[model samples]
Target chain A: MIRTKDIFKSFDEKEVLKGITTEFYKGKTNLIIGRSGAGKTVLLKLLVGLLQPTSGEVWYDDTNFFSLNKKEVRAIRMQVGMLFQASALFDSMTVEENIRFPLDMFTNMTYKEKRKQVDSCLERVSLSGVNDSFPSEISGGMQKRVGIARAIVLNPRYLFCDEPNSGLDPKTSIVIDELILDITKEKNITTVINTHDMNSVMEIGENIILLYQGEIAWRGHRGEVLESDNEILQDFIFASPFLQRLRESALGK
Target chain B: MFLKNILYHFGRYVMMLGTAISRPEKVSMYYKETMRQMNDIGIGSLFIVGLIAIFIGAVTAVQFSYQLDGTLVPVYYIGYVVRDMTIIELAPTFTCLVLAGKVGSNIASEIGGMRQKEHIDAMEIMGVNTAAYLIMPKVIAALVVIPMLVAVGAFISIIGGYLASVPTGVMADADYIKGLRSFFDPFNVTMMFIKAVVFAFILTTVSCYQGYHVRGGSIELGQASTNAVVFSDILILVADYLLAVILTS
Candidate 1:
């Protein structure tokens, strides 16, 4: 489990995260949903120790992440995996090399063993036979899958995905979402995804924290999202015409 | 604000270099990466270096022969002039300029593209020391390979001068050798080596730094590459003058 207590972060004079507190439970999909610039990415970065909080503590299990030195932080990071917004695969390397990067860095596995592990991870992501292909040669969805494969190659205890559904078609987005949720459940890893896609919320909003202007607007299951009386979430939910029609039907208005 | 940011990045670079030195695994990776970069910067640029050296040597020899105007000037002096110029200045300085175009731009664009794509951020998330993994290797490779390229350039230029002098019939080969030997200074040789080393350091460091800190996107990466060469070129001229003044004094 990952926990943030009174986390405060600011850029220059503007506070991006205003004394936010949240607990991300293990073995479930925890979604951080917000409009653009609602501090969703900042919060995610803070949780992962990419950005240090101005004042507060982030605990991964029992260790205070901010308080630890860089080496210690790296040790913690090794146990965690992140799929970047842009996929972040090294362009110069082939897909196989990209997947093998972390193992090459931190592990002492023989080349054959590493190859076996990489092959299995690729198979898990349904990306078999594209090992020699470059990221540019593949489709966007395939690149995201590669990102996920690279993230999970180490068998991390925690997985964080930033805007995993961005730029993908609706159907592809759901597939990626299902892949994430399935991996989270099977591996029993603490999974936190930052997104605003309502379909994802409906599909795997097992635990969701909605942010509005840097504060927690609502936190609950998917079923509770439509039922919640929070005006801010209501405004966000009904703002889209598609969702507005869905809201009207739900409320019988 | 920009100055502060540069200072902050400089500090980060120093800390990363320190980490690279202290960690065994990191040092090994750095060596492997450096070898790869050396091959790219040195071995890959050989053809261009050879082509340029041949033309420059031929031109210098022909011009000198024309100026001598039937005076008993040893054709071998052409070899000496080409050798000295190539070793003491042209090879080191000009080759770096060429590299600043070829290797330097490549480093800048590659690293800048990585930054723009958030690959550096990805490395950070993975607990990788990106500076150690990326920048230091290029630095070390430049230091090792640039001087060697300069030597090769000198050799090529000497051969070019030899071919030009033999065909022109300005003077006998023996007299040319005598003139070259009489004026040869060991200090000058040392000076050229020193200059090559300094030029290599400046070129790679500045180019890598420019690329490492590039902002925006592909357009910015292009801008960074241009900035790297321009900045390094100016620095090279300034450093060259300063070194000449100090050494002569």
Candidate 2:
């Protein structure tokens, strides 16, 4: 499990995350959902050590993340994997090479062994073919799948996805979400996702935190989402009239 | 404010170099990258360096020949002057200035594009030393190949001088050969290599620094690429002067 304690992050007198304390459980899809400027990205970055907290403690299991030196932090980061919003694949490398990058950098595996590992990761992501294709040659959805394949290639203990569904169609988004869910369950990894997609929040939000104006407005699972009386959560989840009507009709109101 | 900005960048640049020189996570990966960079910065640059060098030598020979027409200096002195000038100053300084525009901007754009695309962050998240992986190979490749390029440019320039003057009846072939053999100072070649090495370091590091710290959209990326070339050129010129003073004295 990953835990944050009173995490406060500020940039030049402008505070982005105001005392965020939360637990991201193992083997569950923990979602941080909020509107733009709601500190979702900042909170995610702080969790990943991309940005430091102003004052707080991040516990990766029992170890204080901030207290570790650079080498020690890198040791922790080796067991961490991230899937970026834009699927940050190396443009120059083939899909196979991209997946094998972490292995090549960290392991003493032979060429054939690395290729086998990469093939397995590609298969796990349901991307069996197109190994030699460049990132630009594939569609955005395929790139995201490739990104997931690369992320899980190392079999990290902690997985972070930043806006995994952005720019993807709803159907493809569901596929990506299901893939992440399966990986989390299979590996028992701590999965944390930052997203604004309401579909994602409703579909696979095993544990959810709603950030509003740099604070957690509400916290619950998807089942509790419909019945929650939190005003901020209600306003965000049902912001669109279309969604509001859909939610009302589903409730038989 | 200006002083603060300079100090800030200077400090960051030093820190970046420090990080970049750390022990590699994977020696083979760095080796492969260094080889690729060597090809890119060396073989990719040969044609342009040769073309510019020939022109520089031809111009120097022709101008010196004209200047010598009404003077008491022998016609053979044109070859000697061209040889010394190309070896001591023109080849290293001029060649590096041109590469600061070519290879320097390319490095900046490549790294800056990676930054904008989140590739560096991805690597960092993977526990790879992004600074070392990205910057070190390029610096090493430049250090090794650029001096060789300067030497080749110096040779091509001497040939260029001979072709321009000897073929046009401006001077005899033997006189030019005599001039070429006139004064051979081994230290001047050492100075040329020294300048080449120093200039190469400045251009590569400055360009890498610009790209590594880039933090915005296409406009800012373009600005970073431009700043890479501009800063490298200015620093190369400054280093050239300093080296000439220190080495010659």
Candidate 3:
């Protein structure tokens, strides 16, 4: 589990996250949902040590993340994997080489062993037989899957996904969400995702925290999201008239 | 304000080099990267370096031959002047300046693109020392290959001098060969290698620094590439003057 204590992050005089304290439980898909400028990205970066909090403590299962030295922080980071919004894969390397990168760097595994591990990861992501293709040669959805394959190749204890469904179609988005959810359950890892997709919020949001102007406005599971009395959540999530009308009909109003 | 900005960038550059020189996570990975970089820096750049070097020698020989016309100085001095000038100043300085324009901007753009694409961030999150992995190979490759290029340039430059003067009938072939053998100083060759090594270090590090710290979008990336070449050229010139003074003194 990952926990933040009074995490306050500011840029110059502009405060982004104000005293955000929350827990992301292990083996659960913890989603941070918010509108634009709602500090979702900043909060996620803070949890992963990409950005330092203005003043707070981040505990990664009793290990104080901020208190550790550079080497110690790197040790912690070894067990952490992230899927960027753009799926930051190396352009010059093939999918197989990209997946094998971490293993080649960190492990003494032989070439045959690393190749087996890479193939297994590609198989797990249902991306078999495209190992020699570059990231540009594949579709965006395939690239994201390759990104996931690379991320989980190391079998991290913590998996962070930033906007995993940004440019993907709704059906593909659901597939990606299910993949992440399945991986989380399979590994029992602490998973934190920052997303704006309402479908993701309703479907895979096992533990959801709604951030409004940096502070936590509402906290609930998907089951409770529609019934909650939080005005900000309602306005933000049901922004479109079509969605609001669907919500009203569902609530039988 | 200007001084403060300079100091800030300088401090960051120094700190980055400090991080870059740290012990590698995997020596084999670094070795692989270094070999790839060597091929790119050395073999890939061969045509341009050789082209520029030949012209530099030919121009020096022709100009010096004209100046020595009807003068008390021996016609053979044209060859001597071309040989010494190419080794002492022209080859190392000119070849590196051209490379600062070509390779320096390329390094900056490659790295800056990676930064914009969040590739560096991904590597960092993977517990890889992004600085060491990205930078050490390029620097090491430059240090090894650039001096060899300068040596090749110097040798080609002398041949160029011979081609221009001997073929044009401006000076006798025997006089040119005699001039080439006259007053050879081993220390001057040492000075040339020193300049090549120093210039190589400056260009690669300065370019890497520009690319690594780049922020913002495409416009910022273009600016970083430009700055890489500009800063590298300026530093190379300054270092040239300093080395000239130090080595001769």
Tell me the whole-model lDDT of each prediction, alpha carbons only: 0.85, 0.95, 0.95
Q: What is candidate 2's lDDT per residue for B28-95, written digit by digit as tens?
A: 99999999999999999999999999988999999999999999999999999999999999999999
- Candidate 3's C-alpha runs over 4 A off are none
- lDDT ranking from best candidate downward: 3, 2, 1
Order candidates by DockQ, high to low.
2, 3, 1
Pairs of residues clashing in candidate 2? none
Among the numbered candidates, top DockQ falls to 2
- What lDDT score goes with residue A22 in model 3? 94
How would you encode candidate 1's per-residue C-alpha lDDT over A10-87 as one tens digit per residue?
999999998889999999999999899999999999998878889999989998999998788888888889998889
Model 2 residue B60 distance off true place after TM-score fit, in angstroms: 0.8
Show the colliding residue pairs in model 1.
none
Q: Give the TM-score of candidate 3.
A: 0.99
Q: Comparing only chain A of model 3 with the true chain A, what is the TM-score?
A: 0.99
Between candidates 2 and 3, which one is better according to DockQ? 2
Question: What is residue B145's positional error in candidate 1, in angstroms?
Answer: 1.6
Give the per-residue Cα lDDT of candidate 1 at B41: 89
Model 2 bad stretches (over 4 Å)? none
lDDT of 2 by residue, A183-241 (tens): 99999999999999998999999999999989998999999988777888988999989
Model 1 residue runs over 4 Å out of place are A251-253, B1-31, B63-76, B246-249
